[model samples]
Target: MAALKTSTTWIKGQEFESEHDGNKINVDGDKKNGHGPKALLLSGLAGCSGIDVVDILHKMKVEFSDFSIDVEADQTEEHPKVFKDIQVTYRLKTATDNLEKVKKAINLSLDKYCGVSAMLKKNSAINYTVEILN
Candidate 1:
């Protein structure tokens, strides 16, 4: 097993630091309201898909100046404050005629490449929409 190192900050609303080899990550439970560990999952999903898209598009030689995934969640008001559904919006731009390749890349990410989506789908419903901006 590979050893992963992470340091947690002790507070009522705690923030922690996770380091893996040469990479560093900061984790705060509640970014805006001093909450729990939900942001980690949300950010993970976004990062996972974001990485997949960039790599896949780059390999296909799709030229783009910017790419971003914006995410929103619908939460339950009861105990645990769990997410009921998540919507991810993607913005993409390219000069290539191979738009189908881009869609395939995204499909592969959501269906296979993203570990976070795989984990979260067990507990909640995840939905996504893509808008190609010229």
Candidate 2:
């Protein structure tokens, strides 16, 4: 048997919830009005790519003092829907400042890893770039 749970969610005067694992995420339609879903999606992408990059970079023995992922999103002009294009910029600031290695790490994330990226790329153009700042 499969277990299920309901997670509450609301947007744009609509009411709904996410259901899984016998739990619920309720959406009261207060703070999260029109931008909650997109925020969650973007967060997923960042987290997915984040884990991959960190793991790959660690395995590659690339020491970084700081790291950050910047996601810039573009919404459609039409109503009742949005997000036509989203640009993801992966900025990795390391002490060594190896551009090639950093770029390679990012490529690996977008191509091999990062399930969110793979899925989103099918619907939208997600271009990623890496900048190594020392």
Q: Each model's TM-score, in the order given?
A: 0.79, 0.73
Q: State residue 40's C-alpha deviation in candidate 1, in Å.
A: 2.9
Q: Rate the local accuracy (lDDT) of all candidates.
A: 0.77, 0.74
Residue-by-residue lDDT tens digits, candidate 1, 4-85? 5665545445566555666756666666433346766787789999999889888887777677888788999999788899
**RMSD after CA superposition, every candidate:** 2.9, 4.0
User: Local error of candidate 2 at 112, Å?
Assistant: 1.6
TM-score of 2: 0.73
Question: Candidate 1, which ten residues in sequence have the lowest lDDT sum?
Answer: 27-36
Q: Model 2: per-residue lDDT, tens digit, 54-113?
A: 998899998885688888788877785666788888776676547788778888998888
Query: Over 4 Å off in model 1, which ranges?
Result: 1-5, 11-13, 22-26, 29-36, 96-98
